[model samples]
Target: MTQYRNVILLALAQACFLATSMTMVTFAGLAGIAAAPDPKYATLPVTLSIVSTALTTAPMSIIMQRTSRRFGFRLGAAIGVLSALMMTYAVYSGSFILLCVGALMVGPFQSSAQYYRFAAAESVPADKSSRAISFVLIGGLVASFFVPTLWRFFGDLFEGVDYMGAFVFAAVVVACVFIPVAFLRPLEEAFDVGSDNAKEEDARPMGAIVRQPGFIVAVVNAALGYAMMSFVMTATPLAMEICRIGEASPEVIQQHVIAMFLPSLFTGFLIQRFGLFSILLVGHMAFAVAFMTALSGIEVMHFSVALIALGLGWNFCFVGGTTLLTRVHTQAEKGRVQGLNEFLVFSTTGVASFAAGLILNLYGWQTVNQAAFVMLVIASAITLVWGMAGQLRARRGRL
Candidate 1:
């Protein structure tokens, strides 16, 4: 019961963390356009946020390793409160540079929040880790609803400057997260970090770990899935506006966010039943569907359907990748391995997000979908080949 309670609280914290992150996703690019010196740099703030996360991933993991998860989480929540205030001031001051700086500061907060899944994994049995990870991510579904609704309701509170109200509301929501996070009591037995008897024999070097077929596949699935999803998602609103479908852009983004997380309700079960490789294959298939759907038309429905499929694809790949990662590294190596994985994943995403606006502005929406398709193909091919090799190795071991 205590374990489950901890997971629940982490989930709540995840919800608040996402509400801040997603709300930024919802409005950051548009706000950037309004504040940026050049329209081409409109998405820079969003990209910087992702870049900041990538940069801070390693340090945050190290902090958690040296301290307690609760301590780390509390630290992140405090930063989130500070970032929210910065965001409020950024919008109110009408400074694009300040907004970009605010976005940059929020990166550590989001990076810290990403550890919620790993923390949830720590609270449960090993076999149930996937479900625990998924359960924590399910909080994103609630965030998908709450964030946009929060934006819609409070977005206009400042009358002449609506983004200010949204940022202020985001600040309040983030402040509330500190409460749930402060009370969390993680299972002490799960972490093996401080024990003097910890065996060095079982732990492999980072190079050897990354060279493993499973590790490579896991990182590829996560990085490529995240990058492609961010690529399209970041550009979706801009593309919709280009298509003169701007009015529904917010709702479209909301639906896409929901789709990204809605699958968490059952993705872990599917991974357990079908195996991680199979689920990863299906995730690629989902991305393929999204690409095909995007190419089919430029209508609002087409964009909606494509983004929804993209969301489902991201959910499966990310969850599958994280699950696979757990099998590749031992307890002592988790901090380094997870930090490296996230750094790679968000670096890929940050680059893709920064390029998204440029691609949209230079080429068009079709080109963006085409770029996503290319990445999907590359990831799927690599994972499939790696899985086959692993199977062959397993067969030889059995014989």
Candidate 2:
């Protein structure tokens, strides 16, 4: 198959798998269960999925190195189905801890999910890489349609069902992932095993890359954009729940998440129209708009619009940042650099997710948004400074 067609098919299948897993995993929005005795603990299931991916993403990527994309993707799909089943059983049996275990398993599957975008990005021509990443992300846009809507549709699929119907629906979706795998042509990947040179290059003394203006800026833009977004976005559902503004915070989150991915539909087009760096500016601006809207009045309507804007904002910054950063490294450096990059990226998010409860408990939602705003400022500053410096250097060379 041609490279572009490969990306389209893989992205679509990945989106389907995600739509299922994401719907099943996002359970905190159920009004009945959420009003249960311990409401503060309502989001543990979703947290479980995020935390698992953070801890195991590196290992999952490494394993995929030794194996092909098909094996890893299929394995993850299988695990996801089983996890959904286990979760359903956990709910049926009313075992909270067992439900946690099921959520934990969902993480590895998410880590596997990250590969679809990266894999799709790599298979394309260099000029089209950004568009490729955006294409895979567009799958997320489809998730926007399916996740919240499915949450509602399935929630009522069975009477008095909190999230059980959603889980069953998710299992079916995850199981269907294998169908695409049957046709997925294993694209050549540099991260595959026996990649010693790749590892060594990635292992370049941390100080070296840290000193490189380009490397520092790239990593900072990607990691910080991600970290700051998670910090606030992670806190969003909790804030909404605590404030009692919405009975369906999970459903609201699904909408916000959808908004975040929806921009993927247009980001690539914008990148082609404007430059990659220019798109980053738009993303940063969108983030500011989202923050303002989120904090505008603390009402649910404002909050939803703001959160959705934030998601889309993040989608642009992170997608653009990652797309640009890939150009800063060579093929030999792909595995380690990508690995190191992701390690830092996920690590920051790990800290953000873990700290969300603590931060929210200590400070109110407004404070949480304020902290995120400051972090956003720092991230945007780095990109701006780097762009200016690059311009100056180019002019000096011309002179």
Candidate 3:
């Protein structure tokens, strides 16, 4: 269908979005440190970006549902251009508060861009939904490859400001997505009933949807997976600097970003072959591995290995949880559920991001990893119980 072709275009657009996102993660904390009022709040900008994304999640979903996805995409990109420009001025003028505002504005752009995967799912058959979602995310591989390189290429574009060039280039990259969305046809909402014949009885209440076992597992895995990953990743650069591991900090982040998306290459196939439960279990295990490795030392190799594991874990949990969510919701419920899911996921991640610098400064690197380890264990335990309960129900049905 032509919608599939549109999906490809959206995927390209997703690549551009991820490129901007990765750059933010890579430099936002460091930038915050450069101009923050207090050194301890060095990650405040990054934390605010996440908090902003969380706040925008539901509103963006509502906008897409009421209008066209294309409209939301374009609106988001336009805002992105504004945000990037603000960031540019923020860095150039060395204004910390302005930088936070810019970061906060990025939330809407990210909130809209995140739906690319769901939009891809709408483009294909239900059976191929997971594959389509993965395909859209595969665009991140482009960002993974180019974001750090671009950061370096443009890091010194301004004579005195070190990172201002990066934001300038980021603005240009965000503008690139606008052109693709302009030429594309909007994908229709698949599950919602038309307003002409709308029936309140047909739509399930939010509480009912939230109570589903599958929904609980899906939200838990994705939210916690994201929170755990953000906790450690946000603090890595600062920790690297404290350890005097200068140039290698970006390299470590680059590797972590690459690892995060590389698995999207085959994750859909894994979901198909092994099933969501198995993949989720493995995802939790991957988080465990990352935490354990990080606790082992403060060496560059240790951080590198731990982040790689964290990346792999996030992919499996996030992708698997998202795909599983598709099975539970009807067309009408998509916007509501996805918005709530993203809000919870990003909000908790915001907390984790905010805590990262404080914990790293107050306690130590090992303590940060220790906290991540505890969260992972709880998430893993909950997932296991959910999976077992599902199996028991299946068995009872057979009997």
Q: Candidates' lDDT values, in order?
A: 0.83, 0.71, 0.85
Worst 10 residues of 2 by lDDT: 28-37
Pairs that clash in candidate 3: 191-331
- Score candidate 3 by lDDT: 0.85
**Which regions in candidate 1 have their CA more than 4 angstroms from the true location?**
1-3, 65-67, 121-133, 186-198, 390-399
After superposing all C-alphas onto the true structure, candidate 3 shows an RMSD in angstroms of 2.9
- Candidate 1 residues 1-399, lDDT tens each? 877877888888888887787778767887777787877787888899999988987677678877777777777778877887887887877798888888898888888887888888888878988787777888766777756667777866776884787788878888887877777775322244443645666678889899988898999999999999999989988888778886687778888888988887888789879888799999999999998998899899999999899999999999899899989988778767887888899999999998998888888889999999899989999999987887898999999
Scanning candidate 1 in windows of ten residues, the lowest lDDT window is 186-195
**Which pairs of residues have clashing backbones in candidate 1?**
none
lDDT of 2: 0.71
RMSD of each: 2.9, 3.8, 2.9
Residues 1-399 of candidate 3: C-alpha lDDT, one tens digit per residue: 676786788888999898888778877888888888887888888898899888987778678878878888888889988999998899888899999999999888988898888777876778988778777877777666777777777875564786797798879999999876776654643233245444456779999999998998899889989999999999999888888885677778878988899998888789999889999999988998998998888899998999999999999999898888888877667757877887788888999999999999889898999999888888888889988988999999999
- Candidate number of the best lDDT: 3
What TM-score fits each model? 0.89, 0.82, 0.90
